[model samples]
Target: MKNSKLLIIAAFFSIYFIWGSTYLFNKIAVTEIPPLFLGGIRFFTAGVLIMLIARFMKISLKLSKSQFINSVIAAFLFLVYGNGVFVWALKYVDSGFAALLASTQPLFVLFLLRLIDGQKMQRKSVIGVLLGVFGMYLLVSQKEISTSEGSVLGIFMILSCVLSWSYGSVFVSKADLPKNYLVSTGYQMLIAGFLLGVSSLIFKETWISPLSWSNKAQVSVTVLIIFGSIVAFTAFNYLLKVVSPEKVATSAYVNPVIALLLGWYLLDEQLTEQSVIASIILLTGVYFITSRKRIAKIKVTTKSQKI
Candidate 1:
């Protein structure tokens, strides 16, 4: 029991920190490789590698018919629409603006859970979501968003991605997925990757050999496959089982702060006072949501023990 709790904590930390670092790496990768192709390759490679590891560890990869269909649906919602469309949208929208829009995941997840599963929202969750939105707004410079040349269609696409991701997150929590997280994730990634590959072909993206990619781009892709896909995504799936979807979605709030800090460290970007304040506020909101979930978990465990 203690080990399970410890693993959950570790999983949260991995998603919070590791996924944050993926933004810069993804930016680098998508610069050279086509967005759809990049995503396809990244997820495909990660899925295969993870599945292989699981097999070596003697984990069953079998899936029932329902489980297979559920994995496919999740793959489409989470990876295909959620990520693929966002990648394509990046061409038309500024990254800062896109990040701001994607940060709406918690709000979307909150209402989706309520509407779909009839879960009631706590007042603290509502306050936390509001604070998170405000903090995200401050984190990205308003001047930048206003000045950037973003297409209306692109903005709409990203909003749709946010909705798809939020809905998928909630759906996965209730879906009849495989008993093993690794098996389910592997299938999800593989299915999404194949669909993305078809998208690349449809768009007529010329395949570039991985050997020809720049050292930095290669490294970025590697990091994304390992940390972003395997570690962080697996952690996210595990969290959905234990934590509230709203709390898991709070990672979106932290990701922008991580990007900003990375920008400061790597590119020497100015860390404005507003950015610092926003980070604090964003983290505080995350704390509130996470603490609420943690308290709920403790209560449930205590009740079970008493029974």
Candidate 2:
């Protein structure tokens, strides 16, 4: 039990740190490689590698028809729209800014949960969502009272990314999938990778030879495949099984912070005073929305214990 707890802690650290650094590496990679192509190669390689690992672990990789369809939908929503668009938009925006914008995912998930499942909404959570929106408006539009066209477009794309991911998250919960989380994730990545490869061809993106890629780009892509996709995602899957969903969801908040710090330190990305204030506002709002359910769960557990 003690060793298991230690492993869980290690896994949490992996997801928190590795996932956060992915935004930075992705920024480096997309500078030279086309977004879809990069996404294709990254996910495809990671998917294949992880599937092999799953097999070695003796996890069943078979999918029923319904499970396959659900995986397709999830792949389309998560990798195609969610991650692909965000990666494309990184060309025009700062990585830290992109991470900050993407942090609104929890708020979007809250809204989607209410809309789709008719889940009761909390007034505080609604307020938090609005604050996040306002903070985003300030962050993205500060260049002009009305945001610069490029910034506006990038912000919009990131929001769409958030929405796609949020909806996918909800959908996957109810969808039939492989019993093993790693197997399910591997299948989703495989499908999304194929879709991304097709998109790269459609757009006529030049596939740079690996030898021609800068050392930095090569390293970035490698880390993205290994740490970001394989290790971090595996950590997330393990954490989800052992921890409460809300505890696992803390990544939504921690990732942006890690992203922001790494961007500022490594990439020398922008961190203007206004941007700092906006990040605080945005992250705080996200915290409220994400934590609300956890708090409720704690209360319920306490009451039941008393009974």
Best by TM-score: 1
TM-scores, all candidates, are 0.91, 0.81
Tell me the deviation in Å of residue 80 in model 2: 1.5
**lDDT tens digits, residue span 126-168, model 2:** 7667767777666666652233348878878888897887776
> Which 10-residue span in candidate 1 carries the lowest summed lDDT?
298-307
The lDDT, on a scale of 0 to 1, for candidate 1 is: 0.81
Please give, for residues 1-307, the per-residue lDDT of candidate 1 as tens digits. Answer: 9999999889988877787777678777777889899989999999999899899999999999988988989999888889888877777775655766778889998897677655678878888888998898786555534423567888899899999998888777767789888888899999999999999999999889999999999999999899888888888888887876787899888887787788679867677888889889988888777776343443322221100
Assess the local accuracy of residue 50 in candidate 2 as a C-alpha lDDT between 0 and 100. Answer: 90
Per-candidate local distance difference test: 0.81, 0.75
